[model samples]
Target: MEPLPAAVTAILLDIEGTTTPITFVKDILFPYIQDNVEEYLQKHWHEEECQDDVRQLKLQAEKDSGQKGFVPIPSNTEAELQVIKGVAANVLWQMSLDRKTTALKQLQGHMWRSAYASGKVKGEVYDDVVPALKKWKGAGMKLYIFSSGSVEAQKLLFGYSIEGDLLELFHGHFDTTVGSKVESDSYRRIADKIGCSTENILFLTDIIKEAEAAREAGVHVAIAVRPGNAALTDEEKSEYHLITSFDQLPLQSTH
Candidate 1:
């Protein structure tokens, strides 16, 4: 906690559950998709991406459910489509049902973009986020975002943030295209893209696997502890640097 330890150069952050509350995404935003999926599909089915994604989801459902000819079962009946609704209940299912990050992002973008447009939602950032970002930027620390959410969705969240356009605070953004955050290769790709050695970059996230992957890539790691998440045991907690608040960060400046 001593003035960010001096070794850190660039900062990579996760969106949901780190800078933003996990409840915002899991409870509010995710449920919005569940509630609107039928209406959304009915209206958007003719769109090429929607058609492609639905077809892919069907295949995924079949694979997951272990049925032959696993392409999405034709939902000629409302009951059949209703069953599909059950399958979509798990977001992890949704991600696995369609391996295409583009499709996942497109759907998320449609949801959040509409939510933002209709005033149904505005993005939230932790109290520590804005001033800390400004402070870090002022201290010449470069910033980037790495999230499972699409980069377009990432932009919208920050762009329409409650703090009013926090997107300007970041130097770059990356998403599942590089591979999921759980994989060490993702951090390596990010490090290469940013043109820096991994040791100089710091990754902050609420998920331990992500921090572990960053650590594997030689980046310094910090775990953000937001409320209502599963508490880590002492052994689990010992593996990484932990931060309970943005102000807890060892920033050099005394704002």
Candidate 2:
């Protein structure tokens, strides 16, 4: 790979399938929520925070009622078990479809915070990611994260990662709140928010559509070819710069 373009002053990263393995979320995090949602609710059901999560989920459920396979959450007035069951089922249904609703993300973020705090879970990062981030940070590259995961969930992952806290390496975080990753305008908006031209940001992700979107916004794009990431088409492999590890990023200088 050639040296990174001198105009690139910032890095925008995707989490799953980029800096972290896709299986971390697919095999661990989501399943953790699925297996523990009921127990988590039963344990913390009386807490105002938990109740609020349920309230938001209930609202989402109501909104989704007209849609197929929507799980109905019972109001708090119902029997405690039934209410919890309803919320649990609703959450599971949303998860089954991999929904990213703020309601569902809010609940999942809280649950992950607890799981991380108690050492029941630790975030997974590629072995090369931390050192590369340090090098990039030291070289004065402004770094940011853009992921489908809620910002709080993103924080939890890096805050308790295997390599210790990696949050300090980032300049900021963006979630779906900005926009979908596949939208070119989302890249432009992120660049605008970060006070840079879109051309100054290099985005790394495992998905071709996201790369194309970022490229459309005039940002440089590289696809991370990591283990467990979706296989890239041969056409895609020939069309974009690809790296199997962060160290493959061609920095202009160590200074």
Candidate 3:
């Protein structure tokens, strides 16, 4: 694939694996959530949004397991039930399985917000991210973010970055609300929001499924493999434009 042109009006980027390292989320963010889930739910139970999500989780759990009510896990005790309000905690724990659950991610943001404000955590961005973002923005490309992470957490991550408030670089944010990044529909939704043809938008991510989805939607795609991360397979290597460094790409405007 050719390098992006200055004429490409919008730039859509992935968060966790592209602009940020996968390790940071896997090692730092998920663990933080696991450690704090019980406490966060207890403290925030009174809030309407929290209560609503908890209710939804209960319903979702029933739907997922085809059970009439909250199915007791191996460790469902009165104390554990109290932590998540009976059925909700089990649902929350189940959400942690592949780390794909929206409820888990939402709960995680609540925890991380506290962590960031208390100076216990800061967001990590790739070394290439800031400079490349600055260069693109300076050249008049409209930048946007799409991640599985909730928009609130996305803001928190960028707002509390080691470089401080890199949120200025993005004009918009999106999460699974539109659709999962692995779905072609997500790219189509994002394209509509950005007021650009999919072909005119460039989507960067480290996950092949997401890149494949974007490519299927007619967007340009690049696979980012960060340092100390698992390498893409031979099939993936054959299928996508793979890069270890942002600098390796022809980033400058060719137009």
My TM-score estimates for the predictions, one after another, are 0.78, 0.94, 0.80
Off by over 4 Å in 3: 1-3, 41-92, 99-102, 228-230, 252-255
lDDT of 3 by residue, 1-255 (tens): 456654466778888778888888878877776666667777776789777666555555655675334344322334644647554457445645554555545556667898887777789998998988888788677889998888898998999988898888999999889998889998999999888898778788888888889999999887888876557889989987887776666654523
> For candidate 1, what's the RMSD?
4.5
Residue runs of model 2 more than 4 Å from their true location after superposition? none
How much does each candidate deviate from the true structure in C-alpha RMSD?
Answer: 4.5, 1.7, 4.0
By lDDT: ranked, best first: 2, 1, 3
lDDT of 2 at 1: 66
Best by TM-score: 2
Report how far residue 151 has shifted in candidate 1, in Å.
1.3
List model 1 lDDT by residue over 1-255, tens digit each. 476656678999998888999888767776677677666666666788667766655555555555332334445455755644543443344543444444455566776787777777788889888998988888888999999888887888888888888877899999998998999989989999999888878899999888888899888898999886658779869877788887678755322
Count of backbone collisions within predicted model 2: 0
Q: List, residue by residue over 1-255, the lDDT tens digit for candidate 2.
A: 679898888999999999898999989999999999999999999999999998898888878999897789887688999999889999999989988898998898899999999999999999999999999988889899999888988999999999998899999999988999999999999999999999899999999999999999999999999877888888999999999999999776524
